[model samples]
Structures are given as C-alpha cells and as structure tokens.
Target: MKKLLTLSAIAASFVAPAMAAEEVNVYSYRQPFLVEPMFNEFTKETGIKVNVKFAKKGLAEKLQQEGEYSPADVVLTTDISRLAELTDKDVVQAVDSEVINANVPAQYRDKENEWFALTLRTRNVYSSRDRVGKLGNDFDYIDLANAEYKGKICTRSGKHPYNVSLVSSMIAHHGEAETKEWLEGVKANLARKPQGNDRAQVKAISEGLCDLSLGNSYYLGKMVNDKEQKAWADAVYINFPNQNTTGTHVNVSGMAMAKYSPNKDNALKLMEFLTGDKAQQMYAEVNYEYPVKEGVKRSELVASWGDFKADKISLDEIAEYHGAAIKLLDEVKFDL
Candidate 1:
C-alpha cells in the first residue's frame, strides 16, 4: 500500500500540470468508493477537478516528507487518532472557514481548527442473540471486566485505534491506574486471544465462539448489507455501552488542510462542501455513518438502529490519552 500510494502520488504530479486550473489534490485515507461520489458532485457544482491519492496508511509521513512541494491540498482520514496525528505531525494547517465552523460541532473538531470531523460512529458492544441477548441500558464499558462474562468476550487487538480510543475514554473517566486494572480484568475474560477486525469478532459470535464482542456501529450496517455477513449481523444485537453514564464512545472520520496547499481556494471549497447538506447526506446514505452536521437526517438503515447519546467528552480530550491507552494495553498484555 505504501509503495502504491507513492507511485500514485508521483503519477499524479505528472498529470497535475496539465489538469484544469480549478483543481485540488487530496491525500485520502478514506477509500475511493466512499469519497468519489462527493468529489464528483463537488466537481459538478464548482467546476474544480478533484485529484485523490488513496492509501490505508503512511499519508501523514508522506505529507511531512514532501514538505512545501507536496501536491496534497487536503487530507481525509478516519479515527480521531489519525486526525490527531496530522495535527501532531504539523502536516496540516488550521481551516477557519465559517461554513465548516457552522457545519461541524466543536466537540468533533480540533480546538485549534486543524482538523474537522465529517461523520460519527460509536464503539458498541454486540451481544449474542441466542446466549446473552440485548444487554440492558445500565450496562457500561467497564462491565466488560465483570467475571460473569468471563470466557465469553471477544475483541480485536487492543492497540487498534477503535479500542485504543475506548481505552483512552476509560482512562479519561477512571484515571490510568483504574483503567489499567480494568484492562487487566477485561483481558481475563477474553473468549480467545484478541484478534481480527470488528466484523470478525461479530463472526466469532455468530459461530458461537463468544457471547459478546466489541465493534464499531457501522460494521453492523455493512454486515447487514453483505450477503455472507448478514447471518453474522443477525446473530447479535448491538448495544451502545455506557448509555446512563459517560455515554457511548464515539469516533469520527475527518478532514484537514495540508499546510502548504497550492490551491487554497479550491481546497477550502471542497472542505466546505464536505460539511454542507449535500455531502453530509451522501455520507449517511452511501457509508451508513452518522452525519456530523446537525440537521442532516441519518440513513434509514442507520436510523433503524435507533439514536445513541454519544459521549459528550471532547474528542480532543480523548486524543490526549491515546498514548496512555496503548501503554495500558501493553501493560495488561491484552492480546497475550
């Protein structure tokens, strides 16, 4: 993926000079299918050609390496940790557009405006329908440590960004010492060594490997739509943990402006467009992600899952404890 992104970026450079003057270059961690529709619509509306280089990882380092000569006008990424990485690495600059400010809530964006969230997803607990059934509203994330569920829980790697952010939120609410013990307790209850993606954990539940698992909310929507995965999706009921306490841990897919963007006007326009009604609506319909924009309606399938009260804690605060969360995961030997 790294080599491919590099070669694609280089290929983009040769083609860039011949492209229309009204163009913006995008370095996206988002998959092309998810973002292309919005980009196409943006071009249709503004006459600005959108050039994208998509990769799963290494975009931040690539931007830093390119320095002032980087053709990347904007960067798109999923997870607050990735958004924090861009700001921490100094590869992105603050976007002060009034349109973006109005579109995204303060809790979902950087305090200094370096990054802005476009969509929201929760870190949910999935309970096996035949065994555990839907968990009660009183259930909390900390409850994953309870002995009653021992030998019945499954999850992905603790170091994965989704779980790390959840652990970070735990640290935020419980302090590191308590959160470490919580991690230790949760590890003790694992159905097997932590492995696989969120959907894989759901599959494990379907196969009766575990009675409960941790996963992102959108994966349920995706699984429901997939022919082979629907049975996995059917085997469990998604429950938003910590409903009565801190609220469920929510993460975001977001965007930032490259520090040395050559086409500032077009880049800002794209950013603003992403926050507008059209793009927000597209995100909900195409990706099944909750739109960060307040007034936009969720997709019918997403809305069917019912509304959740997302953790009110600022994502910036959660990003602060990300390293601590990873350290806790290691300290607990969570995947061992």
Candidate 2:
C-alpha cells in the first residue's frame, strides 16, 4: 500500500473552479498518492471535479463490468471485506446522508447507507523492541494463543483480507467452537512459514527471525517514512491489542455509491465531502489513517501510536463472520 499512486499521477486533473460543471468519478482501491490530497481538497471546496481511477486488483470486477455504464461515481475500497464484496455484488447504492450521518460511526457505516468509513486501521502487535522490552507490552491477542508464545509469532496469510478481518473479529468475539480453538493456537504460533507483507512481519522482527507480527497501524506510518524500513521500523513495539476485553480490532478505509451513480448529485456531494471536517483532516494528514470522524485528530504519525478501544463488534457484526473467518483459516492450516 505504499508506492503505486502514479498513473501519470492519476492523469493529472483537479480543476477547482474554472471549468467544473460538477463531477466525481473515483474508483480508487486507495493508492493515488493516498487519495490525492483528499481529492484536491474536495476540488478546492466544491468546484466538484474529482476523477481518480487507481487500482490494485480489479476494481470489483470493474464495477461488475461497468454496470449502469460505470463512469463510477465513487467506489473506493479497503477492507470490511471490500465492503462485503461490494455488498455481495449488488455493487453499492443506498446513501441517505444526514451529512454522512453526522460524520460516520454507525459502526463505520453501511447499515444501508451502502458504505462510508473513511479511515481507521488496527491489527496491531509488532513487538520486538530488542527482545520485548518496555515490558514487552504484555502483548495480548490472547497472547497469540499462549503456549508461551510458541515459536514467537509472525503472520501474513490467514487468508489475508487483513488476516481475514482479524479472523472475522475472532468470530465476533469467540464463537465458532472457540474460534476453532483459537485458530489452532494461532497456527501453533508460527514464526516462519506464514511469510511476508506486514512489513515482511516487521522485517521478520528486525531480523532475529521473529518476535511477533501482524501489523497495520498504517504500517507504522509506512515504517516511519521508510528509508529501507527505518531499521525495520526501529525494531518494533506497536502493541494495542484488546485493552482488557473487546477493543483494538478496527478496520476500514471505505466509500461506496456507484450502483449506477451517474454522479448522483455529485455523488452525494462527494460522500458528504468525505465525512466533513476537511476530508477528515486529509484522511489524517495524507493517510496515516484513523479518522472515522468523531473529532478527527490523530495523524502526527497516528498520534504517536497510542490510545486503543475500538472493537465494539459490528463491522456489520464482523461482516457476518466472514464465512466463519474463512472456514477457520481452512481449519487452521493458517498459511501453512
């Protein structure tokens, strides 16, 4: 999710005032320089015109083969299982908008408003501050299936849709037979076979091979503005797991509308100007994320990675337990 926002910089076009007879095409699976400075400040405050296209996988089957002649009046994505796979393929469209319901948070949108959730990420615990210092945060996630952290955890593909939306919120807080015996004790706490891409499990715990991993707090603000991963994100410790019950399991970065949105009133005024407050503070200063609205401040490197409490279930009740969290990660082969 870093480096890939350039298709000639999304064919350069912001058109703030001079010639915008209203517009809003977007299809973004979020990348064009992390949402083109909030669609160039929502086309410099309502001159409309905001036509992005970026992709990182068939923009939902190209909006189901351009249905309704898809010039796409908004569709953007990122987890909540691609907004429940574009609402089980109906391809989005409900938006009632009380200014995006007073700036999102009906458990991060889409109880029928189709989809909204602008930003907020979490799937934390990256530890390893030189062999778990800072009291190693006593890192919970049910201690990655305790057995005293067997093999010392590390992950990536428990059918990744961000670890199957955190194993479908641990099957909406422990259900599928204790979430399949807690995903076979988190796949027997793997340190090796479950390879790469959560900053390669924080560069495999800054190269001691493993000491826990399962990232996505804006990839530690893209590895503190990476320069070859800033010493593997300064050898870890991002923590934030279940602050004593059901919290810390957030997810989102949404938007939806294109079920034939021939610019539905400029795509409902660009989804109520991206949930107001200056496009949620440029989605927290150019996408470090965590702005599901309410008082939007947090991107001074995601408020220095602090504060917790988020998992009150209902990401539409954990996207209805994502096919029983991908069939309990294929009955616990969890990236074997």
Candidate 3:
C-alpha cells in the first residue's frame, strides 16, 4: 500500500505540471523584434506563456507537415497572398471573435473569419526631392509608364510579393490586358534592372540613380529614423499613388488561429489582445504600420505624412488576381 501510494504521488507530480502549464505556440513570419514586446505584454496580462517559432519562410509548409500533432496555436504573417495561401492549404481555422470582428473592418478580414489584418501599409511612390517636388494630383500609378518618365524610375523585382500584390490591385481595378500593358510600360521606365529592396531604390534616388522609385509607406519612416538612411529618406517625397482615381494600394500584416491549435482558448485570447487598442497602438508606434482597429492613434511621424484615401478594393478580390499578376510580370520580362 505504501509503495502504491508513492507510485501514485509520482504519477500525480508529472500530470500536475502538464495540467498547470499554460502556453500557446505561435508560428510567425514576423520577426522577433516586431512582436516580442506585444507577446510579453500579453503574458504579463494573462499568464499564458507564448512560445514562438520565427521563420522567414516555409512556416505554412511546416504547419501542414505537422498535421494534427502540430503545436502551433497561431500564425502571424504579412501580405494577402500568404494569408490566402494558408486558407487555400487549409492550415488555419476560422476565429469568430466579437472583439476581432469589432476591431477590424470587414474589408480587412477574411469573409469567413479565417484571418484578420492587424495593420496596413500603402504601396507608395518615392520621388526625388531635388528633381520632383510634390507630384501633381494627376500623378497616378498609370503615370509610371508615361513616356516622359522613361528611364527615371526604379523598383524591386516585379516578381516580389509586394509588387505582385500591387500588380494584382491593378488587375483588380483594370482588366488583365490593361494591367499587362502597364507592366510592360513600367519595365521600360526602370532606371536600371529591377534589382533591390524598397529601401535600396530610395537609396538609388539619393545617389541620383533614379528620380522615382516604388516603395512602401513604412520604409520612409524606417529610413527617417535610421541615422544612415535618414539622408535617403529625406531625399524623396513619399507620394500616395492614384489618390484621385483608384486610391493608393494597401497591404496588410495579419494573424490567424491554426486549424489544429493545441491551446484554443489561450490562442483566442491572444488574438483578441492583438486586435485591442494596446497591441494595435504598438504596431503603429513600433513598426510605423497603420493599425487596423478604428480610432487607434497613428504614430506622430506616420500622421505627419498626411492622409490619402486607400484603395477600397477588397483584399480577397486583389488576392484573386495574384496568379494573373505574376504571369503579367513574367510576360513583360519585368525583371529582365
């Protein structure tokens, strides 16, 4: 009886820790510097430890490979295509939260609640401060292709996800044929080959390599804050493209609950917290991203950039044209 009691106590010791341990696993494409503070705050508030596996790519494949045994409770990623890919691959599940629904606008979330955008960023045109003051109101995305601007613009590879999404938006606004033509024209305008990241293009403008470049709105803020890149940032005016027409193209960073989440309750709590004012505020201030939640104050620097109407096309609709966008880039030999 004594031996049996001892054995039972040993069993209980292992079981108790297993039951008492409260944690939620996360598979994230967002870098640690971007999300650690938010996760720490969440742990402080709820006592649920957040374990994250950060990766630049292949997170979707990892989740799929793990199947039902996957420990991932949530997924954090940027851009619509990745979110759409997760949905298409059936790795994430619908999260029907009143908090999330109230915090995010309908257009920023999946129609079926599979994913929700945490923040937004615009695809902006950065123009040389020395060469081009403020672009005219008529300066739309289509103007990038005008013969006058030929050999004056620079951009990253058209095959990149960011450019693909922009091309996708063009396809959404115009048809495939017109988007193809636009791609061809933009290719002709490249100051050199499409060869660098967004900031690289801005740096090129600073070096007088090009007068205009395609970049994200947040990159300007990032550059301005960095001592080295401040000059690059100051060298250009960030213009919201197509403001008078289709509005500037916007992209998002978002989160979703994994289909086989091991900690559903905690995962739900984390999701709600992220959409709340605190996390949303963090996103705005720390990353220079526009929060998805209404009334959340933007960073002073971001607000200083002034306001422009964002293209109201549904991201889902934009996502539908992704393949077509890629094909258009290839057909035009955009990177070549």
Output the TM-score of candidate 3. 0.97
CA lDDT, every model vs. true structure: 0.95, 0.82, 0.93
Candidate 2, 132-184: lDDT as tens digits: 75423335576788887788888888888988888888877878898788789
Off by over 4 Å in 2: 1-20, 25-34, 41-48, 51-72, 80-82, 89-125, 132-143, 150-179, 184-213, 222-233, 237-257, 264-323, 326-336
In the range 172-235, model 1's lDDT, one tens digit per residue, is 9999999999999999999999999999999999999999999999899999999999999999
**TM per model?**
0.94, 0.35, 0.97
What lDDT would candidate 3 get against the real structure?
Answer: 0.93
Ten residues in a row with the worst lDDT in model 2? Answer: 11-20
Top TM-score prediction, candidate number? 3
Candidate with better TM-score, 1 vs 3: 3
Residue 111 of model 2, lDDT score: 83
The clash count of every prediction, one per candidate, is 0, 0, 0
lDDT sort, best first: 1, 3, 2
Compared with the true structure, what per-residue lDDT tens digits does model 3 show for residues 198-286?
99999999999999999988889899999999999999998987878989999999999999998999999999999999999999999
Ranking by TM-score: 3, 1, 2
